[model samples]
Target: MEYAQLGRTGLKVSRLCLGTMNFGPQTTEEDSHAIMDRAHELGLNFFDTADVYGWQKGEGITENIIGRWFAKGGGRRERTVIATKLYGDMGDWPNDGRLSALNIRRAADASLRRLQTDHIDVYQAHHIDRNTPFEEFWEAMEVLRQQGKILYVGSSNFAGWHIAKAQETARRRNFLGLVSEQSPYNLLVRAPELEVIPACEDYGIGLIPWSPLFGGLLGGVLRKLDRVRSAASDLVTELERNREKIERYEAFCDELGEQPSHVALAWLLHRPAVTAPIIGPRTVEQLDGTIRALEVKLDDKALARLDEIFPGHRPAPEDYAW
Candidate 1:
């Protein structure tokens, strides 16, 4: 369990952030607690979740599950660096979602109660709110910080320009701005390498890549034909589109004597400014299996081969024009 500073902050987080999205939806409470316990035993201290993860509006089922785990004591809340998101509808009311100051305040309080914690290590906006100004966003976050409800602020699914805008606003107001960003970055989805990564780098923001394996497509999908055949239609269609590259990827993983999933995770770990890759596992075994990724070091030759298999974006102007 390698640790890295969260963005420019002194706070350290595990390189592998335990994603709790599967809790209460794909996994039961008992299983979720066991997985979290296993994560801690394995030296994992960073956990990421969202208020809307449980898929039960207003109920916050996943947070409730985690709360129970934390309630069991044993320094669970003290040791773990927990991050949760807002900007999703938690109720039917007009103030139930988005990044308005009201919703931000309400959402933070709601999450704290469900999490059974006094403060959130990192509070992120799940997506860009086109309607809300960054002014309102930072003001609300400042209040949270002053009140000791949240330690740091972050963003997710934000465009490069949006991050720039938010950062500049924070700078003017003398706020700390964003410390981390969660983006869809993987072997198949390298769009973030073009601008988002660069923007985060410029602003001292740590990149926490979600779906590091591209929704499991980069996890040796071709080797699991049986599972692919029974997978969701959309995922199957996506797999078919990238079947050739996936075949090559699995063959490369075989040559290296590593699981495709670990290889994919290792690839992200090798990239610049990536603080951690969120891994959501439904079982304790799966959580334990991911520890191998931290040890699977990719040399220059392997990285070059992966680049040839999945061509990625260069920095902006070079990628587009001259």
Candidate 2:
């Protein structure tokens, strides 16, 4: 339940963000609500979701489930910092998706209705729109801020240069720009260390890492071979590809006497740019167990060993050149 400023913003958020993408897909509505309740009990206040999460075009089933939980009251909506994204196709129409001003306005209103809330703490673009200029993006976001529909703006899956361009445009417009960037970062995926982390650090953007456990590979996958047998074929292939590294990683965690999942989460928490790592747990039990991550401290030696196992990049041209 440690709180940190979201980038340069004065707003504070929990170190672990609850991800609601599983709400209507993998988890039943009742189970999702229970997980959210457990998250709040564990002092996790930030929640991330997307309009396309339900996988049903134009049907925000997950948001509706959260809205129902908020409706039951007990200060649920008041205590949470909700972060949701757009940019996925919500319909067959051309204007139903992307970062165009029209879509931003329409999408914001729709999300507000679905979440049963007046304002979103963070409204994000799920992906960078190659066609839409940053000017258009900021202008749309500014309008949302002026109308009190969204308090902060964010980006996901953006390259380092893309973040630079976004901040430059926001600076010209005298807007807040991106307070956060959500990327696929974990112990195994160290590519962001080369550029994306540097950009976010330079621009005062909080890093919210998704898939910090590498889809459970970093979560002691070898011990759960039975479960992997039932998982998707692609997951099986991925495990085979990374089996050696995962074995080493799990061995390291065993030496520390900690669950592999907690160690992975702890690794992200130890990162300088990370504000929080999104944990998408399907059950209340899983959500409750995540609190242990806060306590597993990794010192210099442990961190050095992890880096040896998964070599990360030094910043930019320095990593490539002398």
- Best model number under lDDT: 1
Count: clashes, candidate 1: 0
Query: Going through the candidates in order, what is the number of backbone clashes in each?
Result: 0, 0
Instruction: Please list all clashing residue pairs in model 1, or write none if there are none.
Output: none
Question: Candidate 2: lDDT of 51?
Answer: 85
Error of 2 at 154 (Å): 0.6
Looking at model 2, residue 184 earns an lDDT score of: 99
What are the per-residue Cα lDDT tens digits for candidate 2 across 192-276? 9989999999999999999999888888899999999899888899899988888998899999999999999999999979999
Reference-based lDDT, each prediction: 0.95, 0.93
Q: What is the TM-score of each candidate against the true structure?
A: 0.99, 0.99
Deviation in angstroms for 312 in model 2?
Answer: 1.0
lDDT of 1 by residue, 186-263 (tens): 999999998999999999999999999888898888878898889888889998899899989999999999999999
